[model samples]
Target: MRSLFQTYVHGSISAVLGPFRRYLPAVVLLGLLATALEGIGIGLVIPLLDVVVSGGSDAQGFLPGLLVSFGETVPRETRGLLIGGAILALLSVKNIVVYANGLLQAWIYGQAGHRLRTALARKLTAMDASDLLSEPPSRMLNIISNESWRSADAVAAVMGIMVNATAALILLAFLMAMSWQLTLVVLLGIAAIQFAHERMSQHFAGLSKIITDQNRGLAGRMLHLVAAWRLIRLFGREDFEEDRFAQASDSVRLAALDLQKRQMAVAPITEIAHATLFMAVIFFAWSLGITFGTAAAFIILLYRLQPQVRQIQAGLAALRGWTGSLDEVQWLMTAAPAEPVTSGHLPAPALTRGLAFEQVSFHYAGAAADRPALHDATFEVPAGTSLAIIGRSGSGKSTMAHLLCRLLEPTSGQILVDGTPLSEIDRVDWLAHMAVASQELELFDGSVTDNIRYGAPEADETRVLEAARQADADEFIRSLPQGYDTGVGDRGLSLSAGQRQRIALARALVREPRLLIMDEATNAMDLLSERAALRILEHRRGKGTTLVISHHLSSITRCDRFIRLDRGRIVESGTTMDFNEEQLARMLRTTGT
Candidate 1:
């Protein structure tokens, strides 16, 4: 009981005072005035009812008892006018107070929602790339959109209940003074009903947790399936996808239905207990010989108290789910980034020298020992040179690129640029000098110019158009109905694979970085387009550093040097023409291009 009291008080204080800190003094003053008027309204009802039932003039019985209790005496006629006028004044004041509270609550709710969303968005934007990839977009959206709103609603509901509960308790105290025995009976009945409700609340929390987990899973799956619709269609696996989605959706529905059943049972059980108590209170009141006015007020107090009791229980149950979700969100927010931490700026580009990797080794966490991805790899590329990593599908080519870019740090040994450690460099400033185009293309829903300008937002029109021309994307983009202003659909679904790749390449080219990394960048392009892109890359061989990860021998031939990896170890490294007959045959068999 003490724990619950503390939680209730803390929640109320946080909601009413903390969120509205600047307006606390004014809100409190208004609330106090409102609560006082509400008490007066409740007090006035007793005299008004008394006059109707007792055949009194000007509600003669109204002010006398209260005035006498306060050690005052007055004539009946004067008392009647004073009490009547007091009741009217309280009613008017109560309405105004209610209006003020509504205004204050609205303002507080708006500010609280804005603050929470801003904090959430800020946290999300600062999170590392690995963290962003591990969680689905819809789950993040659910937390930001639905869960935050739920928290706001819960806070508002609980605060309103607490305020109203205070008022109810004060009115109950007045009724108790009129007849202690009747008050005891009513209180006992309410306590018993509340005990039952507490039991219901405990049971409901278990169900609520199950329902929440299932709902999140369903949302995540639906978002994934929708995003992968094209792959599903190309593979002719619509039925399989539908069944997978149906299974997830059905689990969510069943869990929700079960929780609803449990919740629905609570109302009837509470109502039965409350009804039995109300009857017992009436029986006891009559036996104790309470007056008509006191009886009327006591019954009215029960009528008000019953709903409040149920609400307190239901709100507690609802809050359990909310708290559980908040804890999950906090866990996500506090999770560590996937990559290793480094404190300083990234090393300067090799420029006039070379980049070197000495005894590099890395294996993904939790992978089987026998299936380690990369082990003891050693390689180097000279200044103004392009290196193409060539190997079979399971080879460590892409892993090397990730290591070079510091997306993932080596498990052992060092990677150096111009003899400076890669770990010593700052992430943002280092990444600014590099452009990476991975196999998967991400085209945001925006204009062609916007997408091209993504790499260098401040790049002028001449720079953007030059990049597009170099990427061989200028002709296609200009052919669009709106040219550079055309909107790309979600995830670039509106564009063909070749078109999307060209646009992405254009974005990277616009940056004119010190190092350019391409992983299967030409896989989507036709033979002619791939040759055209290679011609463009060759033109800039001495201008900047370039690293290509490809299985295609033709692409590797375009680079100044070729490096081959076998089980993560660099087995061969030389100019393309120096490749042994065996290496050339292996490459031809692997890629068949």
Candidate 2:
């Protein structure tokens, strides 16, 4: 079980409040005003009952005395009516404040959720590629979409508890004014109930963790099922997949049910405890020879007080149940990598001398230390030169590209651009001068023009068309029903593989980058289209530096230089013309291509 203080002071709640801290003052003020108004309405009940029971003959309590003093100026027959009207007005004002407070809370809830989602997205963008790949996509998706909302809701629950606690204290003060002894007894009884309920907090927290784990598994399984539907059908494994999903779903259901059962039990236990306390107070009042009017008003106030206290208890339990989600959100925001990516303040210089890798070595986290991805390898591509990197699938070709892009920093040694260490240059300025089109193409759900001009949104239609023509994509794009306006489905699923690749190429080219990297960028195109794209690259040979990674021999035949990688080591490097037909055939055979 967690204490109320610990639950509210948890770091996750603070992180959730960071973005909306400015609006918190307004939220607190409205909550306080609403609570004060409610106390005033509850206090008015005393005078209303007194007016009814004694018919304006006597005024006993503080509120009753005040009403009596105010009524002296009015006629005796209308004193009760005047008190009743005052009660109605006070209740009306309290209701209005309550409504306004609800609106403010709703706004906070929505804005908090939005901020959390946006913050998580920005966090992902700032994270290293290796850090992101450490977790499954489904897990990240669940946190962004589902757990973010739960975390926001927990903050709202905390606010509700604060408001209820304030109202309960005000009512307690009123009860004490009426009779100190009765208020003390009632307070003692309520404290005992709260102490007993505290034991359930740990249980709720445990159940919440189990539910969170089950939800992550379920989400992962659903994504797998959707992505592998064709494989499942081909292998006749529909029943197997169904059973796996059912197990995940059932685990979530049972955990949620257990949590709900425990949560629902709290309300009943609190209600019974309060009911017994009410009867005891009634008997004590009788023994003390208390008046019926005084006792009735106190019991009415006590009855109202019970729910407010119960609400405080329930809110505490809710916060405990959400502890797991809060912890996840906090971890996502604060976790750092062993080798954090550092940004420099200096702007990157132009690549007049070109890029160089000086004995660079990189080992992915959790990989065997002895077998690095790229080991003690050094290379250079001069300005306006063309270089081809050819190797087998796992020969560290993509890893080299990633390092050059600064997506993954080298574990040892240095990468330099024009004699300056790459780490000393501003990442934004460096990346702005380079563009890459890899094997995987990512196109959003928009028109063809939108996808082509994605990186250069300010590019005019003329520039977009020129880039598309350079990538051999304009012909097919014009044949579509809406030409450049034709919609590309999610991830460009509406277009063929070749069309999608060409569009990606066009997107990269539209940036007019000084350095361009193509990693099997034209594998999906036909031989003729491939040749046409390569022609564009050849024409840019002396205008911009190009690094091509491919297994297709024809794609790199015209390169100024070549490097062959094998088992994370560069096995050969020389001018492209140095590789004769026999050597090229042997290299292809060794790589099994």
Candidate 3:
């Protein structure tokens, strides 16, 4: 709702252009040269017209009374030649200078946009998981793809408009010096019309925000549809999906229509204002019997003034709309996590001993009092030993794993690595020492080798193959048409669910973390594939810490000890041998494979 011409808008414009401060002088000089040339062209038209109209024996040779009545003292022939040549040269220079200014402004704009996107992306990527999860991907995508570029473009447009408008006003002032009465009438009339246009700009600015938000929503909806196309088709929900997307698209369309209507309304008003002002000027000039040169210059000045008025208004409106979009983008980038968070490489633990969760309690962000996800859950696993957590659905096993990973900090309690509390450790380094493979795997569109190497970017091809072999993915990968170079379609759609899981495991394994967490990592695998995966896990068990969260009782039997969670509490804890026949049956029944 703020005026784009306010002080803050000016300050922001200054800040956005600050980086290009060094180039300002060059750009301004170029603009000045162009403006000067334009002024010269307008002022030259009068004398040129007079010369063409005047006729004598000297006119065929050149001209007569060219300087006599034209307020110059040069000879007729020389004066005519000078006036003609100056007009042509000024016109040519004006165009060339204008072109140069355009290129300079464009380069500055592109650089500013690039800097914003690169800086934001670097910050977002390096942020800890807690910080990264604060906002949705759709919002981030919108800021990076559109808003940043929009800000840069608005900065450039506003600069160009300001320079040109100032020049036009200066020219108008010069014309007013010649005839104040005519200038006053034209200026006041134009001012009234511009004020009306400004009133309508408020509506367009509001619509701009809605349009941006809706377009972002539309993109999110389309992405969801594409992601779940298989399920939608199976359920015959094509029409349902289309309707939902249409609703979002329709919202965007309506907002655009509102802006378009306002813009259209502006066009006619501006045209009418220009026509009336011109007619009034001509009427006054004809009555006074103005000289040929004076009338010609006045008309040229009028032509120049109209465009400047229209552009200044349009540029002001766009600047407001762009600022609103920029605010949304800034909000998204600065969104806080559900809690305070920090990021960087964590300090290495002096002892490198095992991990411990001391009376840890965590509740979901928004949940009923009776429905805690993890409550008074105390547990510990020795370093380098594999621990399995087994529980039925809704038993908070995954929540426990998430807490361990620091994706969600415990509401009240402490998790320690060795002797140091996790909160004290630097986030990035702590996460680096751990790796996880969950039920859902996210794979990008890239070669198999590229995907595997993601876990350890510096890993060699040999290391990549070794990790794939460990996850039992190397064979299938090689059997594919391109082997390790085979492309994994978006989200690994080209691979089966089981294959995707294996590849995900390979990605994690390649990191060779001190602690590896697997939350239902083999859920999509067949019995044989599960067996192969367990062997791969066991093969590296003694070398590093492995924690598996699963519903499969058989899987935990291989673990040295198992913990069971119920209603956010660790209801039972003991070795597999400690389970009585009844207790064992109860566990199996609850899992109910």
Candidate 4:
């Protein structure tokens, strides 16, 4: 019991509830006031028993004797009425304080939940893009959105334990004053019962872990349903998915049912124990030749003390049940990448003179050192010029593009902006002046205008329309059911892949960034649309530099200069005129570009 209390109260709950710790003093004061009022009411019970049951003659013991002496100071005729009214008044005040304390605890619970969710979001944003990508999206979302609430409930359980223990201890003091010998026996018996009950709490901790794991699996399955429903339908896996989901759900239901069974059993078992203790107290009183009024008052106090003791046991069980989730919450808040993302204090990068890759190379974690994803390759793109990268799938074309965009860093070499290393620039400040449209397009659930404006929030309607026209998206967008106001479904799946590509391009162009990168951005567009998009690229020359990665021969031929990668190494570089259509086709065949 002592170990569990110390681990949760002083350990698990401490960091989880740190933000709300300062408010505990006020909670303690309100709890103390409520307990004091309850103790006072329990003290008055003996005087009431004397007036109503013993005809004001049978009062005994220290508390009853004190009340008896006070009763003597009052007129005997009205004493009974005064004592009963005072009891009701003290109870009413105690209930009021208890209500306020409940509200305070609720506020703490809400704030704790809110802060945890927001902090998780901030932590994810602060992480390196590669580190964030390594996390399972479904499990991360479940922890932030669902498990956080369960953890916050643990904080409420801790507060409940504290308040209930305070009331229980103060009521025990009342019992001790009335009859120390009986109080000793009662305390010892209750201690044994709690000791046995601690074993049940140990079981709850295990059950809580089962429930947490099962719920995480269930959440992952549900997310798969939302994200891949189309694929499920296309593959005709409806029945299979249903069976898998049912199994996951049943695991959660069974584990949760077992946990609830133990928790609900707590109150009833404590009730039976208290009833037995009640009978034992009466037998002890009779053996000692105790009066009816004094014994009656003691029983009344013990009955009132029953719920406080019951709450203490139940609260501890609940804390054990939720502390499993609380541990997860704490882990999420403190978990960090093996190495922090390298951030520099330099100002945003400037692409004034040119950009250079000085023997840049990269490989993903855990891959063979010799089989690097991108081998040592060097290139340069001067300001106000365009560079094209052409390679077949798995040639590390995308890796090189990501490096230039600062989404991933090269393993051994440096990428320089003008004369500065890319890592030295402020990431966020530099990204504001850059725009990228890639094959993995992400369109939010909103209108075409909203998606386009996402690239430049301050873009006016004229600029939005111009960018759309440049990407050859304006005609199709205007033909939609609601024109610019049409809502795209999740991930913009409601639109064709080609339509989404153009919208993504429009989004990139709306920003008028100093640097633009397009990786397989036109693969989904028809031949005419692809050519028109390239024409738009040609029109914007000299304003800034453009980097294009495509398997299309036309896209390669249109650029000012091009680099060809094969097996993660740059194999060739030259101007567009260096290769005729036949030579480009022969080169593409030999290099698998």
Q: Whose TM-score is greatest here? A: 2
lDDT of 4 by residue, 22-78 (tens): 898888888888977877776776766666556665555787788766666666678
Q: How many residue pairs clash (N, CA or C atoms closer than 3 angstroms) in each of the candidate models, in the order given? A: 6, 0, 1, 0
Arrange candidates, best TM-score first. Answer: 2, 4, 3, 1
Tens digits of per-residue lDDT for model 2, 183-232: 88899999898888887555888788888888889989988897677789
Per-residue lDDT of model 1, residues 92-143, tens digit only: 9878987987788778777776776676677676665445644667777767
- Pairs with steric clashes in candidate 1: 344-425, 344-426, 345-425, 345-426, 346-425, 346-426
Model 3 stretches astray by more than 4 angstroms: 1-18, 50-71, 127-134, 146-149, 284-290, 321-324, 336-347, 350-352, 359-377, 389-412, 426-428, 540-542, 561-577, 580-593
**Candidate lDDT (C-alpha), each:** 0.70, 0.80, 0.73, 0.81
Task: Give TM-scores for every candidate, taking all chains together and pairing residue i with residue i.
Answer: 0.84, 0.89, 0.85, 0.87
Q: What is the lDDT of residue 220 in candidate 2?
A: 95
Candidate 4 clashing pairs, residues 3+ apart or interchain:
none
User: Each prediction's Cα RMSD?
Assistant: 4.5, 3.2, 4.9, 3.7
Model 4 per-residue lDDT at 192: 75
Better of 2 and 3 by TM-score: 2
